[model samples]
Target: MGTVEETLKCPVCQDFFTDPVSLSCGHDFCLTCIQAVWETEGSDEVPFFCPECQIFLPSDVTLEINTNLQTKAHALLHQQRSALREHTVVEVTGDPLSLKCQEHRDELKLFCMEEMVPVCCLCVLVGMHKNHKVFQLHEACVDFKTSAADFKERISDKYSRIRVVLDGDERLMMQIIDAEEMYMTEWLEAQRGHMEAQIKEIDSLRASRKSLLQEEIELRFLQQIKAQNLWNPLDLTPIQEVDKDLCDLEKLTTVERLVDDLSVALSQHFPRMWSHLSSPALDSKSAHPKLEISQDRKQVYWRTQPVSEALSPQPYDSQYSVLAQESFTTGRHYWEVIVQEKPYWLVGVTTGPVDKRDALSQSSSSLGVHNTSWCIYHGYGQYLACHDTQEKQLSVGKRVRKLGILANLQKGELSFYNADTMTLLHSFCVQCTEPIYPMLNPCIDASGLNTQPLTMFWIKDHWDWHINTEGAKE
Candidate 1:
């Protein structure tokens, strides 16, 4: 009885009853807890009892009675007991039968997904773990520990890369702003100088016209006086007549020339002044100002793209090392093979004038767009100039759809791509130091509507070598 008081709790009503009842089976529990469960079944005398053990009661014994054991159990509950509560305090919170492990007395940390109970790892392995889902705390902790370190490293690296990109963007913006300010200042000064010069020229023209007008008026006045004196029958004073005519002529010429010069100056200056002042607004649409810095940090061609109109491509025949050049004779027709090793081709097309230029540059302008002509599709695996051909400005007929493979034995890498799309289609490692001779076959159809591409070959040192395509075995 003392052992039962220390360990077991009722499954139905949870509390340790004053009187403990023993069923027909060996199981025992509080009498009140079983009675309460019986009442819930709505029977005057329950056909079954010991709800905890589910044992049947005797049909002949139906009376409810009190026993001396009830008084003794009640006195034991109020007495000083063990640290692990000896008396059960009835609770309605959750499952009443659930209890800590009897072996270690430890709260279970593992969850049995099947039975929906917390258990220790040992209990799961012996009972709940067979053909059922179980979660162990130690396993979860180990998995999280491994993932946490990797995530932290990734986040740290990402932030560092973002900072570098932001710094570069800030530098570019500052350069653009500075270049625009300088360009505006220079333009404004030039406009002011031109306007001032025009104004000075207008003033000079007015002075010249004024002098000519005065001279004409003086001569006419003198001629009028001379004719009047000559026709007079009565004698007249020459000085008084000349003085009166001269005064009237001076007044008329002054008013007439002043009005004419003022009108001319206003008409000329109005349009010029307005144009000079409004030039800033018009200048906004002009090319974006740029700054070019030399190796020594000195200003070079400011507010200009690095590319120049006079720029020409250097010939590849001189710059690159030729791997093989073989010529064959087929009677009248000459068959030839020329293989050259170079950095992977930056293939493009252009449609502009191509009278005198390298074959590559001519192809690009006729086919490629600006900025899209410098893509490295294979070796470097960049997609820079991929979209240039799609632009409407680039002529459609001058399309470049030829790919060049670059196999660098020194670097142990092979890079190849689609020439038209500038997409990196292949990249792998090479083992052999010797150069690989890629096969060449001329396109059968060369109709202008769907022009055939030129076959390119790379022969390594005159040997009949073929690309070993055995999963990078070579």
Candidate 2:
């Protein structure tokens, strides 16, 4: 390949970049391949520098892709791939071995992890699985079986814990209900016995009165009536009345309330689980001297005059920006910002605080201007996704009043969205071992036309952005 052709190749991978980015020194490279080289080295004591140039560079140097060069490189790569495709003879089962390739029919003892298929040695060398991760078929089976066993055991343990709680609660509730029922039954039994005794006494009184009426002499009947208390108008008295309520209704209400509280508690569990996914409040310590951080530290705006207060010897943010204090190392996270009519703005995520000695020049301090962060920049009408010193111009259909950023470190993906409609604006694949934090820069006011403050959006109740527009209406 000529020098021009070699220019399209990354120094680390020596291949055309699927996604290209340039360092501050104007050296182009594949973003993924370079990240692999940098991330694997894993030594902070050693200075971060370009592989090809061997020049010392800022540990957090910005990286942004040159689209024109990226296009040319990809075009060249496609041509090469097409040429390779034409020369390779794709014949299957050439040796008629026991484990032959399905397509080419060569010996298929290796398993392609990426494609989840068995392939011959030829496929592993130069076919579709050439660049993919592969292993012996037996090794893949053993690994997957071990993983399945571990997952099953974990799931069963979780279920067991949940079942124990549920069973304990069920037993307690049943005991209470049974106790209430038994108490009511005993009371009813006592009332029934008393009513039966009263009925027996009434029957005996009537029988005696009949005997007195049958007396042959009127004098005898008068004597019997005078001796008996029942003779006095049958001693008129009412029978006992039944109770209005059979059981305590209040106890039932208490049980219902307990259930309602459980429902509410269960509903809130998920929000607490993923609460870190929301935006962390901004760090005032990282804010520039010319910016004012809100009392809540969720907002930042430029002041007409730089603040007279000093934030100690630590370097102030050089890009009129504020970064998040929290350093997230694992899990999927999401955050949003309210830009609302701002003519110039930058928003994204960055690394943990670096010492003053590692701080970059003011120009290079801008988020996305270095490899340590990824961000979107908007000035005038243009939108760009920036990393290192290179940028890719973005096409936005409408003005973005708010922005959404999603960081899935496990997947090495950072995606930007238009928060209003949640439409994708841009995305980046990042693989860095350093912890990351959110960042924002409401660029200096442009001739008094752009003064709106940038705000960290407080996501409510599981990403349901029911943003109240009352503030906007005002």
Candidate 3:
């Protein structure tokens, strides 16, 4: 080959970019290629500018010639392109064979922890594998096989359990979504009603105000016309010199001001109408339900189940205290048992306390107390009833006494019966998640005489009331 001048030149140097320096930008060219620009007047740094873009480089510049790039450049410069390429390939393949220690050379073996490949013993104490978690080549494979089985079984079981939970969550998620959509519809309806009511009020006010103003304007104009007509040239005595000019100006100014005020009021108050119409307000909870995996990867529960009238009642409810005790105390409170059920369920006074009036001691006005605790049913509502005991003589109005609140309808309904006469009380519909409070007949005075106080609840087909000390165990 002819003497290769190009071979002596750096490819990055091309003409003068030899002894090339590489910038952070990955552009490689001779030092001279970028040095001048970096040293330009007003330039704060030298040998620190990107050659291609003239973008300034940081002060902590590193311009080392990349060995791989230099090699490639040199190969390009040489006339033997194919041979150079082949030489590069051989360089990549030819890692020098590591020598084995004399002691292990004859039967040398090694284990690669990373690759899990067995190597000659010499490779073990050499590059890369020296600090690796390795065992003797023969022992490593056996250990791996043992551990792999255990891990496989464990992982499989975990994933299987996860799949089961995932299936449950998927089903529950659909219900949750449906519940949320229903809740949103209800909430939106409520909000729309409220807003429309306000809108109607505002429109009424506007109409009334406009009508009054228009009447005033018309009256003023009429007065002005009357004044102008009085000055008809043919009229006799100038009619007290009707000043139409003054009348016209006064009416015009009043009408203009009134219109302006109404316009401003409308703009200020009704500005949000379009926005509300376009993007309605979301319920307290977003309609969207999010599904996420638990940190421990356990069962899934809803973050929010959405609020619907059918599912949840307002929080600070006082109706739950229908048959609250006069004085709450242990063993002294009254128990209202619904004897109609097989379980003979009852929840009554557990604490000794009473809401009081003056001049009355616990004997006169004892109130019933409850544990305030309840049983929660998954996918259903909880059931509870206040204990009405002799400790407190709670009274109900005639109407309330005739009607008893029903609750936990999903499990069963609550109906009250006169413990004495066993009379049937009226049954009431129980909304979801709401506890029923049965308004009671007047407290039986200490004499055990039943008074005709307003009592709620009528007789169901067959129900009885009984007090068993054994069942009263707290």
Candidate 4:
């Protein structure tokens, strides 16, 4: 027969079960242990398989208590406790409890500091830890405890410092938000007031024009009544002159003139808003093999040679395009590109770290698709603003030579302007979370008609602005 201790012990925990329960397969285990096993197996709604027999139990199956097993476990535990109590009494009386090595059956006098284990004299001579540094067990224990306490204290100090830094950062962020809110509110209110005043002035002008028209109408009626009998054609000249003047006044009050005036006002107010002119250089590393970058890194164009084989491992498969070396994360920046009648080209900004392999496919990798980038595409005789796979056709009358980009990250605005004419082409309001890089695609034409290099204008200091031939060094 098996020993009482072995018979009462649960297989799951290898200890006497507090509440033994039997499964459908007649296997007994601690109630908590079986439940924990089922939970770990992820069988909350489904039946779980038995650990030993692999027998499936129903989800709603009730657990039955193994009373006989529980009784045996309790008796065995009581006997063990009684034996422990007797040993405790002996130890209390003056006899010290001695620790012995399991393998050698000798007193463990020395401890291996390197291995952190107690060993006997025989163990030190021939055991696996024979070459390990040895120390007195009591001394090693005290040293480890003191080191653990020191580490705990250091951890506490670091945690406190982190909390203090986080608190300071939070306060700083709140202050910044408060200042921005106040400034925006004031700016908006001023704009509203200006618009209201403009509306009143327009209404007054309309009233004056209406009065002049009514007076002319009444004068013509009187002239017709006097000329009804005389029938003289010379009197019609004065009415015709008055009508021409009225037409001139109507032209002066047109919507087109109003829009032109507004544009002029805005340009004056926000002149050089982006003081920092970022002279972006072409990044050769991200350029395609078919695209040739200038030595000065200011221009990029389509190569004459066919791109059958890559000179180096191409970073991206956007075979006609290249990105700028510089990227913008915050603040306002302005840059100009001189296309100079490049019929086919793409100029814009990209939230970079563009995947090289994925850019091979045009449909997915194009600048505007999926909010990866925004750009102005010039194809043949038309201009298009593209973003998120959508294109907006721009009505540009003349061919654009110089393209200006004004990016204000804080204001969440990106504007494109015809630099030569100083006319706004398109603007985008985007919430960008990543750094944006200027991108260029000097498209390859089969006819070789569109080979003009896309050149970037480099500005020096604010006082003396000059185009640097070798591009921006920084």
Candidate 5:
């Protein structure tokens, strides 16, 4: 019942619809007017809502022509055109559809690339976009369209190559899994065959031992019978008259020997459960200048000289620190240091590229105050583990003479042990990124009374013995 003009008006522009389209919410709108509203209101990938019902419209929503609405709009427009033709008396004015700046009321002829907006001649001269990079509106539109095309082509090419790349990766993974499976199967089969052979050999040896025992039992029984029959009842003498050969001890000795051999074989076949000792020598370059090193480079101690001669002009920095020549980056390694009766000592590992300057005042520059190093310090009857400027007190019993360090770089574990008792004192779980070297600090006592040297215990490869012929001359 409403007027055709009123019914055909667009909600956005408040004018007759140019090309009408219907939304999913059963609302009609001018296609160009709805598009402009959406472009201004939402991002390209975001959904827009209907003005009346607030119904959701997808970013890729298709605009279908509303035939009925279009026909009504066209009829109303025709009537307006006829009325305009009949009047045709006043002077013509500028196009109402031309875009104009809101403030200046002048035509928007240029686009400011820097500000990403349109500007009129007046805006360029005095507005906020003055001196900004700009181009003609048509030229800006053409450039944007070309860039959009290039972006779309690149996205299409990437999408086309995705399937091939994924297929190759999946194939490689499957091949790796298959290879691992084959290797494990072969290894398991070989181990099974070896175990079966050992079991068979054990069974054969057990049967042979059982037969020997049976023979011995029978022989002993026969000897007992013979001795009972030959017993002297009148004299009540023992069965000494029986042959001494009958009482054979060789069989018992053979069984004992067999048991001992089996024990030795079993021990040789199994891997050792304890950590193996390794020899680590001190790196002379890492030693403090005042510390003295033995000829073997396995021991270090503070120099026993006058204070003025031994001490450096500059105060002690990391002058007490020393590192081992051996560096561990992977796998497990263990070494022990003899710190018997030492009043002050520190042992741990440090990564290379460490700061060796005199910065004792700063905890960050000192050992065990950063991620690069970790150590256990012993002083004044207290034990502490230090790392990243944090110290943790350890509850270790009586002081131990020998200290052991076990490092498993792959597992990111460093363990300190009491070598005398083979007991773990403390352990640290760390995040190691580089090769680590054993570090030691042979600290001098405050009263300068303790001078015990820190020695690395090395297992000798050969032993030498000398005879004292001087006693014979005497």
Candidate 6:
């Protein structure tokens, strides 16, 4: 049989263990010895292999003290000392870790963040670690932080794949909506044409009959009345009856419920969006002479008369429009606006510096009409998306009161939404060269009807705060 010393030696260290640890391969080694071996031969970026067994272990495998081996080692030392009572020495008052500075004899307490090691008071005050940084043991540890960071990255990778599936679903749903809108629009237009023809015939018959009555001669009036025989009562109803529900209340409610559920399921992504959810205020400096911004800077509206006060040095040549104060240069951002019951308005984003040459001239540098901007315009019973003077007529299922804008700079895309229903209205793809600012235009007041100011909608400090308000769940 081998000596007692040979049986207690670590496989890697080849010495008596100090904080022994056991691997799943049934091999034992000193904790520090195994750490040094793996750190030099392998790494946290790759699987760790047992030095003796060569068995692979996950990179995240934690190193911890083997209590059974430590107890056995302590017992063996106790028995060896008992056999030589003349030289007995023990210090039961030491710390549980049995660690103490060789010179100061103080417990190793603080951890030096820079050096990645434990330190004592004198080591931090006057020794080698005098100028090194440190933290209390209970406050933070490199091991715990590294482990947490690695695990968080894994979770984020998995969630990113899940988001891809959700995005595909969203795209499919939007296509279906567009298709249904197109078919319904065709039917509505045909019915409207038929109604117009019937009204024109009725108007012609009424005018001719009135002229016959004013014929002056009684004989001619009688003859004219005989020649013009009055037709049977006209059918005022539509020629083709509406078989399907135009407004399905049940389906709308179901949509709202589904959106609510989606909002909850996707709350994980909200922190990113919410972190930048600043309801950017209207920049009065960018407003037209006839446009007015609220005192609080959240609302903007077109005025009947121009501002009488002396205007600033900047040009006041906008089309009753203004840009937001905040500008975004990178990353994905979402913002919303309230256009509730307003008849005419425009909402969009603009990139690059404002041109002093045109200011807000509708024909020159107007939003959506200019190459540097994109916008959604509503006026005279039409919802249209405009970019670079090219207009794409949008088919919105319902009247949009709230508008949502999502600007994804990395992907080079901008998406507009029907905020109330979370339905996508349109999206634009553009490569940005610089910063982009949110733009708002409360179009000209028509006969004192569309005077309501456009209001900004956004999340403040809470989660699950905005699903009902607009296109986003805050």
Q: Against the true structure, whose lDDT is highest?
A: 2
- Tell me how far the alpha carbon of residue 377 in candidate 5 is from the true structure, in angstroms, after superposition: 0.6
Write down the TM-score of every candidate. 0.22, 0.38, 0.15, 0.38, 0.38, 0.38
| Pairs with steric clashes in candidate 4 | none
Ten contiguous residues with the weakest lDDT in model 3: 278-287
Overall lDDT per candidate, in order of appearance: 0.39, 0.74, 0.38, 0.72, 0.71, 0.74
Per-residue CA lDDT of candidate 2, range 119-175, in tens?
888898888888889988779999999999999999999989988997887787778
Q: Model 6, range 212-307, lDDT digits (tens) per residue?
A: 768999987777766765444534443455456763445445555776788788775655544445688778877776788999899987775644
> lDDT per residue, candidate 3, 1-474, as tens digits?
323445344343455225567777766666665565566644563436564677777887866755555555455544345554533222311112322333344333556777565556555566445666667755886888889998999999998997897577567655665666677667667766766776676677567546544655777766755654633543222113334553344443554575577558755754221121111111111111221222422211122323345522322122111232222111111123222211111222112222322212333123223232121100112233333321222232221111112232454433343343434442222232323222211211111111112211223342211223235433
Q: Which tens-of-lDDT digit does each residue in 1-474 have in candidate 4? A: 578687677778888986898888877789998888888987477677677798988767788777678767766676678664432121111112235676787767788887567887788889877878887677788888999999999999998997897677557656665665677567667766766776676677567546544755777756654754434442221111123442243432454465567558755754353345667888887776677899999999778665454332332223467888898889788998998756677889887555634443444265434586888888777898988768899999777888999998999999999987868999999788888888888877444456578999876555322334225434
Cα lDDT of model 5 by residue, 1-474, tens digit: 477578798878888787789888887789998888888887877778797798887767899877677767766676687664542132222233235676788878889998677888888899888888889888999999999999999999997797677577557656665666677667667766766776676677567546544755777766754654634432322222334554444554555575578557755843331335676888777676667788898998877664554544332234476778888888777788898867678878888455434323344245544677888888767888887678899998878789998887779899999987978998999688777888877775343445678898777652211122234336
Number of backbone-clashing residue pairs for each candidate, in the order shown:
12, 16, 35, 0, 0, 2
Tens-place lDDT digits, model 1, residues 351-422: 212222232233323322333222222111223323334322221232234454444445654444443454
Off by over 4 Å in 5: 1-275, 308-318, 354-366, 462-474
User: Which residue segments of model 1 deviate by more than 4 Å?
Assistant: 1-46, 50-143, 149-153, 156-160, 163-167, 216-474
Candidate 1, after superposition: displacement of residue 15 in Å?
Answer: 14
Model 1 has an lDDT value of 0.39
Give lDDT for model 5.
0.71
